[model samples]
Target chain A: MSEPIDRKTVESVARLARIDLPEDQIDDTASKLGDVLTYIGQLEQVELPDDVEPFFGAIESVNAIRPDQLTDSVDREQILSNAPDADGEFYQVPPVL
Target chain B: MDLSTLSAAELVKRLSSGELTAESCTESFLERIKDRDSSLNSFVSTAESAISAAQAIDERRSTGQAVGALAGLPVAVKDGICTAGIATTAGSRMLEKFVPAFDATMVKQLLSADAVVIGKTNMDEFAMGSSTENSFFGVTKNPWSDQHVPGGSSGGSAACVAADLAPVSIGSDTGGSIRQPAAFCGITGLKPTYGRVSRFGLIAFASSLDQIGPMARSAEDCGLVMNVISGHDSNDSTSAKNDVPDFTQTLNDSLKGLRIGICKEHFGEGLDSEIESAVNESVKVLESLGAETVEISLPHTPYAVATYYVIAPCEASSNLARFDGVRYTHRAATAKDLTEMYCQSRAEGFGEEVKKRIMLGTYALSSGYYDAYYLKASKVRRMIKHDYDSAFEKVDLILGPTTPTTAFKIGEHTQNALAMYLADIYTVSANLAGVPAISIPCGLTSAGMPVGLQLQARSFDEASLLRVAHQFQLQTDWHTRRPNA
Candidate 1:
């Protein structure tokens, strides 16, 4: 907590988020993110109660499984029409290899 | 004077009694939007079919056919909620061109109730920032003074109602998004309990914390909107199975028996003296109505903003992963492969705050720091929830200032990250605990801007919350004040 976060951490984390952080923004973005993290670091000061479950928002429901039935879905054409590159029934994407 | 200045209840009565045709009412609002939106920048886009839809409603009502409860009501909706044919941009370029194929559950409910969609109001991109300045469309100026912000992510929704562009509007709240904006704009907004309203079509910001609710000129108007919007949805599993109540039926509930709590943690150092007096004055008005106030302490409150920032972003990073340049959203044309496309699309699509949060989330959930950050934050979240749980045992509602100060000038805090996050200090605890809360204008600051008094209630207790808010509104005229726009 004593050390401010560095630019390398921002780049790696942005990569983890699948975002390309612009080179010019790295220094400023890292400094700001470091300040926020330092602010968030206050969480480290409090003692957490035992067995704190993973929060899934306000609703207490976890993995709310329902009957697996085929319900009406959005029309296929309507769904495809929104894709940036649609190939008839499927979304067309760049080559994997 | 124009019909745009009329209240929602008056508009509804006139529409139902045939004193005002639906088309004329819709046109009046559209005209207001045309006249003021250029200056306020509240709307992202207006519905082209609004006039014709209003005409249809008028025709149905005249022919003695059945019309819904919201017959002919013109309402503005935040852009984050999906509207079948309208663009559902969450103020992010990523979904800027994305037109939803279906109406969100709440929007569908509004349509069935005969409400007309006036337009999609502007918002912070993905409902992220505390000010609407983060929007891709452009900043929505505060209606009270063009120099200040109309608090955000739901900034546009609050401004629309405050400026009379619409009688009421729908807005989504993740952390103070709805209430803060409503406070900043001198209006009424409610953040219903987590499961109180269906989130089937609200664009996900933090799935666990996000909820859709109404913002209007009065709590009674918000209650009418809530009656249509709140209920269980099969499409959303986390939605409560409880039957929705008639919110309008509860407004007449007396304030005499209620015990509202005063959280001392909220009054200490960071609060502005002006907002403090305004909140103290609101307590007097409530007490005059026979309500009692008690002292309560939320010991864990100091850690709430820290907990929310950590927890919300972790959820956001995971939720926003769907924007991979493949289906339904913006895509970068220059990418040569799938991975490059994913990286490029999001980088270009999201604004600075969105990306910052996403990265922060990715880091917190990363292997080395997961236990130290996300896990610890989650546990602290429970501690915060426990504080509210214990407090609720002694009181029916908790009262505080919605914001530390009045609507600040735009760009004032945009450069300061921690300062921006600190603004939600008083409002985020309700979201962290999944409770219902509201913001109502109680007084004006010396600078002549509105000051909002916030009240929080236990989960699923919006009926009591709205009732108390309604009772308070009747005793004061703060909610009646409109911006010069």
Candidate 2:
């Protein structure tokens, strides 16, 4: 909980979430998040056994998949129909690096 | 006859027996949506196309053709679900105009079973907030008290069902999104085991904890809907391949010898007195049904809220990265470069709460902090799951208050994010453990708001969960009580 959440850190998180935040709001959010972190810090007092394993995913299996089955799906036009901007066969977007 | 007041089982019976035509039920609900939803703000999009769909079902009925199990029963889907040409916003402006090309696997299953989707309901933007206040559209008021919030990210779905706008609505539970609001509004809602239902079309929030389940007036209807929606799906790699049981068929079995565990941690200090009474009274009803209750310990419960806050947002930060403007959804109004465009689009599209979570999650999972915060939290989450595993060894099911308090006034906790986050204290543990849990109406506060009692069962055991919940519904009429909207 003592870990500091600064503006740059907040901005990086927004980027990870794919939401662009204004430079100004970053510091403000960092402070507010600091309060939330301080609140969550209360959990540190709860003691548990050393051997107990931490839970990361669901109790069940993970990423269990099957071979790609090509079944009839909607056409590209229908699939891309709602894209804000798209070319004839592709979703149009600004150039990516 | 108000279509909203009817239960799915009742409506399905009438539709099947020809006592009520599918077209009539569709028209009634559509009319109710037109008349009430403007003020309630429950539905995001209504199915004008449903009239034609209903007429087709009517035609089939007249022709003696086979109709699906839920045919003609009106269901409201959470906006997060892909509805094939219908907008699936996940209540964020980022995907405002994004309509899915294909139906979600659950949607396809419902259609095959003959469930007529009435509309898509509103939710917290990206399913972040406890109250629907975080929705990009606007806040959804509790149907019981218009000034108070309907608990959310599934708030709108819960509100619609509460006000009788839709017979049964579907909501996705990431934390307590579905069950909390169901409790707040005095309805029955279930969050099945993580892989029990396919998440193929659900807009990803925290992929690991997210599960789409049923919200309706009765446990039976929830079981009915669960039976239809639960099963394996190739599209969702995580969906379980096990055979789904007939939830309704096993619902009435006596809970005579089944053990119900009551956690002392849940009935702790901060819980509202009214909620405590409601849980106690519901337990009495269970006792009347001949089931014995045993006090159980979930010592790690205190750390559950903290663990969930770290884990859910950490995953959401990763899952939501797809919303970048370069690839999809919102684009900047004006930008000098691609970077500016990406940033501006995101800043403008997401709501404040969503941004807050992104920041929190990002910080926790950041390079320097991951092991200390995110990894540490994951370890606590494992302990929480272990707590449930240990408790289940002694009892068949666990019961407690769904939310410590009933729905608060709309703007009550908006300024205090942590207080609102704490509202999910009792509900998040189940999500962390990936078990089947349900919230059913047990009692109401003096202010007339609903109080929900939550019951949880081990992995893939929704059958027992529903049976106990259904028996509770049978012995008590709390679930049948409705808000006078």
Candidate 3:
């Protein structure tokens, strides 16, 4: 059996993820997260040989490079059309200050 | 004859003969969605432009112009795929109002093939859950039984095809999102080789495992769509540059001497008895068709769900971090500072499951715990792939249940996230190994829910996988069965 994740750890992780959790819901969320961690703890039982390499993706394919050339793919107006808050020329975001 | 009941292949034949116009075919599907979609909730939005596009196709045909392969067929796209000028929500509130100004490469290919775009179908939020219940839009009910869930994150795509809302649909699979729901909804869905289909416009969940494929009433129809969608794209770096074969060419090929491996691990405990018997009966059918079947052991199979939970969520955590209240995502209306706005926006925009996964991924990928969790899971993922590599050396393909059990009751797994994750046990390994796999309806349970038989093949060898599934579908009547609703 593994150690259950405490509320402090949950809070720390939520902070790292940039998500805010209410204090009242922290305990419940911690316990639920603990359950999932315990379930995943089974992976620790697999014996890995020293020579085994971790697999990140499927077979490696060589990158394709093309000659640099000027091209217009997407129109500037089309690109800005989906922005939630956009001025006539640029996206409008809150002031950095 | 009712146009809604016709298969994509049959519809294409009629359209080719000039007996039916594309406009009439698109209108029929749109009318069906209007009539039945309220109860099923399969479609998130219907496309008005689809009618105009179909009318153009009819005009082209009248002028004796050549039409593409999938002319006049109405196809539904999963909401996760971007469609130009259409709202492409990944079933999350974060993208609820976000519309892409450009079409996904697959959507462009579909239009080039002259297939009518029906609309966007609903799905799990950000392609996260096994049940469509996680969608911010609302849960999509199983067309077979309204009380049950349509398996997800591709649940809406599967349910739409089964209920005849659209003749065919496209969905992405990252750890069985497409195959599991297809099993539950009694339709055929394919998750091609990791890079067989381009991922240029698919919203990423796990980049290494995500693949977009076809979902339809038959494997033959999937092949028809595959011919149009499969090819290399310069936009997606991971997409394979392998030559695209005409998948429909082998649909009628004999399966004599095909070696099929029945993984002992897949049939073990927790599999429903009805599904087990149905799968066993399917093996017998394969044997009678002259294919050799052998019992093989994929010893590391049990660890697949555990490894997937770690790796997928970790990748998702990083992928979804882009939604910070900066450029185009949901922003908090009231915020004193940037950090507070980022925190509050993510907390409000993401659903419970998405947030839980983000938290879990954050913990796994965090410092001090990275080696013990993320690194360890990656090593185990290699072992899972090694097992499949060894099994494929002896057999041409692997066969098993698509899901351990059929579709469960809606809200059954909402509270228990681990239980929901376990539902993907039979399907995740294919994604982990970057192989091609498919789910086709094999049988129905005593309660009348559909069961799917899964088949997996070597990387980029989707031709063999589709051939076997097509032959089985030809001999069985399960694919022909429809819901009473």
Give each prediction's DockQ, rounded to 2 decimals: 0.73, 0.57, 0.65
* Ten-residue stretch with the least lDDT total in model 3 chain B: B323-332
Could you give candidate 2's per-residue lDDT for residues B1-485 as a string of tens digits?
65567778999998999999989999999998899889899988998778889999999989999999998988899998999878888899988888788899999999998889989999999889888998878889888989999999899999999988898999999889999999888999999998999999898999889999999999999998998999988788888887889999998898888899999999998999988987898888898898889999999888888888888888987787777775455787676666766777877878888877776787788778787788788788888888998999999999999999999898999888889999999999999999989999988889898999999999999999899988888788888887774
Could you tell me how far off, in angstroms, the CA of residue A50 lies in candidate 3 after the best superposition? 1.1
| Model 3 residue A38 CA deviation in Å | 1.0
Report the lDDT tens digits of candidate 1 across residue range B259-311.
99999999988898999999999999999988899999999999999989998
lDDT of 3 at A13: 98
lDDT-wise, the better of 1 and 3 is 3
Candidate 1 lDDT (Cα, 0 to 1): 0.91
Please tell me which model should have the higher DockQ, number 2 or number 3. Answer: 3
User: lDDT tens digits, residues B2-32, model 3?
Assistant: 8987889999999999888899999989999
Task: Assess every candidate by TM-score.
Answer: 0.98, 0.96, 0.98
TM-score winner between 2 and 3, please give it: 3
TM-score, structure 1 vs. true: 0.98
Model 1 alpha-carbon drift over 4 Å, by segment: A50-54
Going through the candidates in order, the fraction of native interface contacts each one reproduces equals 0.79, 0.56, 0.65
Kindly list the per-residue Cα lDDT of model 3 for residues A1-97, writing each as its tens digit: 2467998899999999999899999998989889989998988899999988888888566666766887668777776766666786887666657
Measured with DockQ on alpha carbons, how good is candidate 2? 0.57
Interface RMSD of 1: 1.6
